[model samples]
Target: MGIGDKRKSDAERQERRRQRLAVDGIKPMTVHFPDQDRSIVRDLSRRVLDGQSIRQVMRELGGSNQPDGNVVPPEVLAELDYVKARLVAIEREAASQLAEIEEAERQRRTLEAERDVARVAEAEERAKVHTTATEAQAATRAAQEAKERTTEALQRAEKAETAIRRARSLPGVRGRLVRWLAGDVLPD
Candidate 1:
């Protein structure tokens, strides 16, 4: 679709070619057998050139006996190992950060729970104080009412004593007459 895309496609194509070549156990250099003898070959790509024993070019065309030839190069293996190490480091760092976050969250929850407990305690204390104050107010009001009633009863007793004294000093009708007027003696 674009220039960058074309370059990407080209790079992908080359990578695929390299992988295919690796799978086929094709190497840049190989060893060849020339005239019933083995000889080292530098390039395996040339099919037309035939040199005897003097390091001829030959393709080993690998089999199960030479499994190392099917693997990637040592440099590629080293690079993959480096990438894996970096990824492992990143994962460990992420795990540490996650642990810190979880610890902080736990602390926050603990604080919230403590705060809730404190709030409940405060509310309970306030209610208790309010109830105590109400009880005290009721007791004070009852005491005031009792004092008023006692004063009224004392006044009535004083008035009854004054009436009895007045009736006693009156004349010879001291017993029944004083009692009847004071309502202490019932009239028949």
Candidate 2:
């Protein structure tokens, strides 16, 4: 095999070894450190090599198995529970009130929208009524003017009929009336 093929076979062999170790509760890891922390990495690696896992070293550094003077008392914990319950109740009440306010606002907006629609409808009705009233008034005026013209014409016709009767009663006017008005010669 070539050099590249040999290296690939070596990596596969190492991976199989890692899997076998993991099944026996032993896992391998790579640790990295900054150039300035080389000393720290060396110390950490030395502890791991001594059969102490990283977690054990970290637990010892974290002050485990030591008396803690800052332990919270049961009384304080109970009071904290009460305070938390009170805070939750306050938050729930505030949320309920907010929801109610939102509902009322929505209802108010709906009422306003309904009023706007009603106003538009009323305005349309008023326009229709006003137009009808104007048309009716115009028709009444036309009818009245026609009646007055007919009355005047009838009065003038009555006056002319009376004047004709008066002229015919005169002696010679009747004889001339047949010639001038009727265009006929007078018979004996």
Q: Top model by TM-score, which number?
A: 1
Clashes of 1: 0
Query: What's the distance in Å from true for residue 53, model 1?
Result: 33
TM-score of 1: 0.51
lDDT of 2: 0.79
lDDT of 1 at 106: 100
**Candidate 2 lDDT score at position 103:** 100
Error of 2 at 71 (Å): 3.6
Residue-wise lDDT of candidate 2 within 62-92, one digit each (tens)? 5577534457779988999999999999999
Query: Which residue window of length 10 is worst by lDDT in model 1?
Result: 50-59
- Computed on alpha carbons, the lDDT of every model, listed in order, comes to 0.73, 0.79
